[model samples]
Each structure stands twice: as structure tokens, then as C-alpha cells.
Target: MPQSAVDSPDLRLTLRVRAMRREARDVLSLELDDPAGGLLPPWEPGAHIDLRFANGVERQYSLCSDPADRTAWRVAILAESPSRGGSRYVHQTLRVGDLVTVSAPINHFALTPAAEYVFVAGGIGITPILPMLAEATRRGIPWRLAYLGSLAERMAFLDLPQLAGGDTLLVRGDLDTRLDLTAWIGSPTEQTGVYACGPERMLDALEQLSLDWPRGALHVERFQAKTFGESQGADTFEVVASRSDLVVSVDRGCSILEMLENAGIGVPSSCLEGVCGTCETAVIDGAPEHRDSILTPDERESNETMMICVSRSLGDRLVLDI
Candidate 1:
């Protein structure tokens, strides 16, 4: 499948897997390097790639390795309980030397500059946080972490030098009574950033706990789509895909992405429910009724981009940068 970039829409690379190793019990980390020993695109902490497997399954994985290392990119995959073709394929079928397709890194959960940071991670959610720790250390920023998992052996990269290098890391299993969010997170300050990525239950708890915190103090990324409400009452809208100069009417039941695809405009998309940021498109004109699970409230207010798969035009018509 073709992928779209914010700057270059038609950016996709076929990278060869250099190494695949078991990081935890069921967690496997894959190291992808350029096929011809060339440097890959530069990425910052918390950036992720839309990895398209040969089995025709595409999934998003966070770039967990040090961002300074541009020669190779590393991502850890968890073998979920119920097989979602992507993780299962990576665990069972994918080989070390096999070539795989990936999109340019896209980051919605970027490590913002802050006076300090509080990182909370659960299970496989630690992938993105692993890199942010290094970045924070390099920048000489004070930070603390509370890494939670069901079992010690289930957490990937617990032995990373960064984790060992810090005394503020509180890596604990679910049974550990000392994993107190109240004491660990404390009260948020104006310049302190609280970043978390995990299962819905943990994120939901963090969301409820951080309600009184600053508007943009806490950042979280979900592995699946949140509980989205019913369709909007004003569902019918016209979309002007400006790059292709195509206009189409999207009806009550249909989505902008569906309409665009039917019009022969193949925009890269996955998890059409709006969790993955794959179909995020630039908004040229008009306000979008943002519904994606990725963007923050600040981002939605900015109205710069929208996940066309699920979001609609707030007004009668919208001009999109296709």
C-alpha cells in the first residue's frame, strides 16, 4: 500500500531487516537497516512508522532505538492475545533478512521541550518512552518514569542502559503496591510534561487523574481507537481534494476517506476507525470536525490536519491538500 507523508506524500521505503531478537517472553524487537548500507531518514523521539508487512498487513510501531542512530531503526512488537495479523506475522512468519515496507516517520506524540517530564508506560507502551528517556538525558532535563507491566519478563528492554542509568525509574509489575500514581505523578507544574502510552484502562485512569492538570501537560497515545460517539447530525458534506482538484459529495453513512478512495484517490490508510495516524491529511481550508484518536485538544484546535478516514468537514464544504 502507498503511504503519504506530511511533506512528501509518496514516501515509502523497502528496508531490510538486519536483526530480530526476543526482547521479552513474547515481545520481539526488529532492527531494520538500509539495504545498501545507507542512512535512513532522520527521526526524533516518539516518531513511528507505518510498517507494511509482506502479508499485506500494515501496523504502526514506535521507533524505540536512539534517534541519534540514523543508520538503523528499531521497533518492538508484542504478540497480542488475539492475533491481529500484523503482530502475529512479525512473531511467526517474518524473517531477519526479509525486506519490509515502511512509511516515513510520523510523530503525533513528540517529546516537547519542558522543564521536566514524567513518563508513565504500561506493557508494550514502553516502546516510545524508551527513546524519550535518552533524549531527556542528553538534553540534561530532569525526568522520572513509572514503567508498569504484568510481569517483569514481559517488559521489553528493561536492561537498556538508560533504564539502568537512572535512579528515578520505578519499573514494577502490576502486583507491586508501590506503583502509586498519586505519589509518582504528584502535581503537574506549568513546564512539566507527563507522557504515557499504554492499554486503555491505564490511559483512562491517567486521563481521569490528570483532569485538573494543565491543558497540555499530559500526553498519551493509544494502541487502539477510543470510544467514539455516534455520527454527527450534519453528516453530508462536500470535500474538495485540491491536489487532484476533485470534488465529491460524502453522504451521511459514508466517510471522506471512503469517498476519496472510490474517486480513485488512493490515500494511505489503516485502522479506518481513526486510531492510527496513517490517513492524516493536511487541511487546506475550512474547519474539520476532528474525530481521530491521535490528535490532542491543542492540535484539534489548531485545525492543521485531520484523519480523513473518520473526520468530516465541520461546514458544508472542506478544501483538503489531498
Candidate 2:
């Protein structure tokens, strides 16, 4: 179901910033390439890479450039108002030609085959949709995009020519502008899929509208970990790292990832809050309480893999592929 293939989740590379450009008022776009002039790993639409800054801060940014262009990878970073160290570092300290540590691409928001596609992007959420649109055009897939931005000057990729056409709708204004979600998306039909990415409130509104649609109709990606209240029914559980031949006891306050890391078993990970799918571990056996933000409803129901960072066991024991 729309699940993107992760080539190598633990693959890391050192790349140099080939160039930097100001796409918008607060947006900085960086083009990364190998210093030795070599091709990088191939990725698809809705894929993102984890960039580890010089300051040792890691953050995931969507691949906004054409996936076919393997010469270089592009990502846009918004100068976050609160300055979470990542945005500030990229804007102020990171420079062109600087070496950076980057993780291989990961995709939890892959675009699946559909008769018709609908995309809704809000502000920086437009990053992943850029490549999706390119792929859709290459495949001759019928699609429409609704780009909503708070301010005209702050929006990125405004100069993109692909966005100018009847198939796309651009709405820019302040907080006062109200969008009719139902009319914009219309009634769902057979084989019609909707992909949306934005702030919590924006996604929340869409979620409300999706209640009437068929299951697995609407797909979304989040910029942050959703608020899941305190752990409930969380008791001590045991995890068997099958590959490592070790069994670790997980405490109520501790997580499976933490337990493995503490036991000298490293699971290549980033965004330990479960927003990133770095710590996704294969579940050989046992039921897991999935709490990650990356998986689809169908994927969760399948219980094939579990994000050890935030997810836990639903039973007394869990067997992991590690």
C-alpha cells in the first residue's frame, strides 16, 4: 500500500554543499553533491534525507528536486522562528562547499498508483509534493494541486513554471482566508487518492473531512511528532533482538531503542521522537502497539514492522529482527 522502498536506512554519506540559493524570504535551498563528483543513491518522491549539521544537530528535509537528476540532491530549509538549532545552523553557520553528514533517503509518504491524485500543500509542506508532481507528469498521471501559503513572499518555489496551469490552484493570503475543504477536494470516488502535508491544524482539518471518505483515501506527513498522551497500560515488556541474540528488558520510562542502545546494540536512528522512520525495526513475532507517525493505517494493521523509538509491545514479549 503506497509504502516506499527504503534502499538502505542506515547508509550515511559525507557530501558537500554544491550551491545555496534563497528561494523565498525565509527559505534557503541547498544543493548537495559528492565532493569527488560521483552519483548519489537514487530516491523517489516523498523521500527525505537526514542532514547532520556541523553542530551535531540532525534534522530531516524533503528532497525537493527531480529524482532522476542523480547528480545532486536539493532540500529547502525554513528559518524556524523558534530556532531549533537546525534551522539556525543551516541559515547562519552552514556555508557552500561545507562537508555535511547525510543519511540515505527514507520515505513513509510514497505516492501510490491511482486513477486520479489530489495534493494539498501548506507552506514548507510543499517540498515533498514538488517531486511528486514531477513524477506524476512523467507518468502522465492526472493530478491537481492546492497550494496554500500564509504569505506570498514567504512561500518557496513560487517561480516554478510547472505550478502554472489549470491543474493547479494557488491560494495566498493571511489567516483570514478560509478554504472550503469539501469543494477543494470534492467527493471521493473510486481509485481517487488525496495526499496532504502541513501543520497540525491543517492536517487536523483534513482529517475531519476524511472521516466520510473511504479508508486509506487520504495520506499525510507530519513535520513533528503528534501529541500522544501519557503511555497507557504500559508495563514492563521484554524485547528479543533476534539478530543480536540478546533480550532486553524495557522499562516503563525507557523505550526499545534506548534499551538496545544501552545494551551496546546500535540501531541507526534520528528524530528519536518517532517522527522519522530511522529506528523502524522488523517484528518477527508478537503484537506491537504502533505509535509512530510514519505508517499508514493498513501498514499498522499488518504489524510487519515497528518503530522502536516510541512504540512498545502489546504483550509480554516481542521478537525483533533488529
TM-score of each: 0.91, 0.93
State the lDDT of candidate 1 residue by residue for 79-158, as single tens digits.
Answer: 98898799999999999899998888888899999999899998899999989999898898988888888887898888
Task: Name the lDDT value of residue 201 in candidate 1.
Answer: 86
Tell me the spans in candidate 1 whose CA falls farther than 4 Å from its real position. 1-10
Writing each residue's lDDT as its tens digit, candidate 2 over 214-318 gives 888999998988777766634998999999899999989889988888888877777877888878889999999888888877889999998888999888899
- Cα RMSDs, all models: 2.4, 3.7
lDDT of residue 277 for candidate 1: 82
Top candidate, metric TM-score? 2
Clashes per candidate, residues 3 or more apart or on different chains: 0, 0
Ten contiguous residues with the weakest lDDT in model 2: 1-10
lDDT on C-alpha atoms for all candidate structures: 0.86, 0.86
**Model 2 TM-score on a 0 to 1 scale:** 0.93
